[model samples]
Each structure stands twice: as structure tokens, then as C-alpha cells.
Target: MEAVALHISNGVLNGPVSAIYGVIALVALAYCVSRGRRDLDDRLAPMAGLVAAFIFAVQMLNFPVLPGVSGHLLGGAMAALLVGPWVGALCVSVVLIVQALVFADGGVTALGANVANMALLGTAVAYLLIALLLRVLPRTPTGLGITAFVSSVFAVLAASQGFVLQYALGGTTDLEHYSLGAIAGLMAGTHLLIGIGEGLIAAVTVVTVARTRPDLVYALRGLKRPQPATAQGVAA
Candidate 1:
């Protein structure tokens, strides 16, 4: 018989670890709520809904990896790039909430850790890394694509590390059998492929939006849109 898939379950974490993650998730989500209320506008409202839905749908189709492991798009980096970090976090959080409560995809007790890792850590890493990269790279579509790709790769890895940290703190698994080093290596290694897929999808989406509707892509907000090849040096 095949081993059951983990699906972001936190069965390994104990009570104290879960509680700590819960508190952190609550505080972070509260902050996001505060920021979103102030920064979110009518322009972003529709996009936010669409992005959240897209992430929810994308997460449903998990592709098989080595043996029992499977991988899926976190969509955190893409969301953060399209929307602001606060709203992006909210988007992923919403997806996680529905998955946990309605579908029972992840553990009810582990919801906090799931949100903290995928929603908070993933989104924050994407925003910070891409922002830093934008400083060195040009303000063109290619630059933004590159920024999104690199940031997304790191974002997934960071989220995996979050899980490893939780496991180290209060994992239910025997240390000898599922050692911290081994767990971290496995999580990070599997997510590396997932991250590459995430980066590619994020880059393509950003490039598409930048080409057609640059206004929708929050990361490219301040930067000037690229002109068509036929309209070189032409005023519109």
C-alpha cells in the first residue's frame, strides 16, 4: 500500500508548537487586516478576489513527486507581486481557511502553522526579496519577471524551513527516525522543484500582465510600462 500524502498537515507538531503558531498567525493576520483596510481600494478589490480564487484552484491539483511526496503551487509569491503583501497574505490565508474548515485538507489544529508558513512567511519573503532585487535590476518587464522568479524560488524554500523549525520544536515523529536534518533536507529538496514551477508561473503571469495591463501588477506600479516593439520611442 502507498503511504498517505501529507498535504501540509502539521500532525508532527505538538500542542505548544501549535499554540505558538496560532498566536503568531492571529497577530500577523490582524496586522494584515489593519493594513489592508487602509491600502486596499476599489481597483484592487476585484483583482484580489480573482487572485485568491486562482490560488485556491491551483492548490487543488497536487502533482506527484518522488515516492509518496507530492508538490503544488503555493501561489504566495505571485499573489504578493500582483497585490501588496498584506492583501496577498490575506488571499492565501483565505484559501487555507477554506481548505482546512470546509474540505479538511489540513489539520484543524495546524491551521495556524499552515497560515504562518505559507501565507505569512511565503508572502513576506517574496515582497522583501523582489523589492531588494528591483533595486539592482532594470525597471522593465524582463527585470520584474526575473525578480518574481528569484523571489518565488526563495519564498517556497523559506516556507519549507518554517515547517522544519516547527518540527524541531515539537514534532511528534521520533527524532532518530525523522531527524531534523533529514526532515529539513527532504522538505527543501522537494520544494525546490515546486519552487521552480512557482517561479516560472509567477514570471509568466507577471510578464503577461505587464504586457497587457501593467496597472494590475502591484510590483510594477511605480515603474513605467514597456512600449510595443512597433511603437519604439513613440508617444501614445
Candidate 2:
């Protein structure tokens, strides 16, 4: 069986660290449920469902980056861009929970760490990055696409850093075999390539949705209306 390094394995994190992450993840999930309830109206139901399903499927297909390392779509950033941040976090959390419980894709005990890194950090960072980018960039489809691409990379990179932090604290993995610096370096570096793939996929998806169903794109919702045509142009 090929070993995967991204998801923290069971017993890799000590009880204290795991408990801490569990508490944090639970708090975030509660908040997400509260927020998602309001956001998941009939209008958003189909889009949200589709986005969650797509993310789940994409995450299953991992691309190899190195000898033992592989990376998959985190999907938090893309979900946030499509839905709102809170609901986006919730969407990814659902996938992580199901993957952990049903598929045993991630460590059962490490569910909290996985959710915290992939769902909370990814969605929150992506939301902040998008907001910051939108202030400077024009509010057009092209501009939104650029924002999605950049945010996706940054969000996944941020999540990768979160993993490094977890590994630094009470991690039972090859920490004794390898230095913290080495672990951080490898995690961040590989995720950089993963982020590139994430950015491209997110950008293309956002552009396609903007072109086809602009109304469903939450990121582009508040764009300013174009100026009205002058009387001469209207007459002509």
C-alpha cells in the first residue's frame, strides 16, 4: 500500500494536540451550521449540492508529486467563491467527515486536524484573499477569475502550513527520524505545486460559471452595475 503524507494519520498526533484540534473543529462546525442554514436557500440548494459533489469526487483523485507524496483538491477556496465562506467551510467539512467515517480516507482520530486544516483554514483564508484582491481588481469575470486562481493557491498553501504546525506539536510521525525544518520544507514545497493545480482548476471553474450562471456565483454578486447608455448612444 502506498503511504500518503498529507492527512495526519491516527496516533501521529498526541491526545492533547488532537483534542485541541477537535475542540476547534467542532466550534467551527457549529458556527458553519448556523451560517449555512441561512445561506442554503432553495435558490442555492442545487449549486451547493453540485459544488460539494464535485469537490468530493475531485479529492478522491490524487496526483503524485514525489516518491511518497500526493496532493488532491482541497476545494475550500472554490466552494467559498461559489457559495459564501461559512457555507463553503461547511461544504468541505461534510466531505471530510464522510471521507473519514465511511471511506477511512483519513485517520478517524485525526478528523479534527483534517477538518481544521482543509475546511476552516482553506475557506477563511480564501475568503480574505478574495476580498482583498477584489478591492484592487476590477469586478469583471476576468478579474474574478484571477482572484479565484490566486486565492486557491494561497488557501491550499496556508492549509499546508497548518499541517506543518500540527506536525510540530506532538506528532508521532517520522518527526524523530526527520527534523522539523525538513518536514516543513517538504510539506510547503510539495503543496506549492499542488496549489498551482488548484489555482488553474479553480480559475477555469469560476470563469465557466461566471460565463454561464453569473447569478449563482457568490463572489461576483456585489459587482457594481455598468453605467447607463447616454441619450445619443441610445438613440443611435
Candidate 3:
């Protein structure tokens, strides 16, 4: 049996559903581009390029999941944490577009669904979780690392479900042996392991950057640790 990449292939979804997702993706990315304009400045602009490139490179290396299914780094959480959410979406979208067009990794017709899932849904979910985690967790390198790990895991799971939802809506595959529930369960279970691997990579990467230059970490920017009481204040 040939290996199946996690990316949705052509003919998996009907034309109407695919077209609907394509429109949604275009509109969402247009919004991102509008917002990303403000987010991309001197520092972030360069970082965005690097983030996109890194994601593109890493996604090429696939790991075995089930018998014939393979998975790779989604890079949604990493991009959103490293850059802001808007630019992060763009980064992931660019990667997916390139992969589809150049490498034919994913189906060209399914590009919209791919972008919507990995770029928009994955990035949004991860960033929201990171924001929530940072509010309670210590705003240190260790804390950010933990946040990255947790968020990445959930992000991958969420992205996997996005596909399930799409499949439910307009799946062309025959379901003689498998039901929708079975498909969802399998996707969730396989993606759980993929999520763990992605989480570790995301954690280490975030922690390293946060330690060296926390300013560049978009997730760390708003987090402000309370200053410790000084010796002079204590003496007084």
C-alpha cells in the first residue's frame, strides 16, 4: 500500500464543498494580509520569512503514523508563537500553496481546505490557547516552552478534526467498511502521536528563542512578570 500524507487529496471532497472552502480560505487570508500589514515591521518581517521557510522545510520530512498513513509537522503553533497570528497564518498558507503547486504533496483542488485547516484553524487555536496559558503560567522561558508544548498538541488535534468535518460535509469516498465516527477516531488517535512529536519540537524552539530574545516572541510580548520586591523596600 502506498503511504498517504495527512494533506487532503483531490477527489476526497466534492466540488461544491471544495469551492466553498476555497472561498472561505481566500477571504480569511485576505483579512490576514490586511492585519498582517500592521504586524510586519522591521523585525517581524524578516522573522516571518524565516518562519515560512522553516515550516516548508520541516513539513517535507514525514513520519510513519499507521500502516500506510504518514504525518509531518504542521508548524501552526510554532509560527503563531514566533510571529503573530495573522502573519503566522500567512506563513503556513504560503507553505501549503508551495507544496501543492510545486511538489504536488497535497491536491491542488483541495488547497483551500488545506489552508483553512492548517493555516487558519490551527494557528488561531494554538494562539488562543497560548494567550490563555500565558495569563496563568509564569512568563518565563520555561513557561513559554510548556505553553508551546500544550498548544501545539491541541492545535494538531484541532487541525485533524477540521479535515474530519470537511469529510463529513462532502466526502466522496465510499463508507462500506468505515463510518464517520470511525474515521474521526482514527484521525484523532494518529494525530495525537503526531501532536506529541510536534509539541516537543515547538517547545524546544520557543524556549530557545524566548531565552535569547523574548522580544521576538510574539506570545511573550504582552506577558509582564511582576517585579520582585527590592531589598530597600523590605528594609523600609
Candidate 3 lDDT for residue 14: 94
Model 1 alpha-carbon miss at residue 15, Å = 1.3
Runs in model 3 with CA error above 4 Å?
1-6, 65-69, 223-236
Candidate 3 structure quality by residue, lDDT tens digits, 1-236: 65545588999999999999999999999999999998899999999999999998888778776786677889999998899889999999999998898777789899999999999999999999988998887777777788899999999999999999999999997799999999999989999988888898889988888777777888766445554454122112
User: Candidate 3, after superposition: displacement of residue 10 in Å?
Assistant: 1.1
Top candidate by lDDT: 3
Best candidate, TM-score: 3
Residue-by-residue lDDT tens digits, candidate 1, 107-211: 878999999999999999988987788777765678878988998899999999998888788887776666678879988999998788888878888777777
TM-score, one value per model: 0.88, 0.89, 0.91
> Which pairs, if any, clash in model 3?
none
Query: Which ranges of candidate 1 are over 4 A from the true structure?
Result: 1-6, 64-68, 222-236
Tens digits of lDDT, candidate 2, 1-236: 86544466788788889999999999989989898888788978788888888898988778876786678889988999898788899889888888888777788789999999999998999999988887787666777789888999989999998988988886866646778888788778998889888888888888788777777888766435453354121122
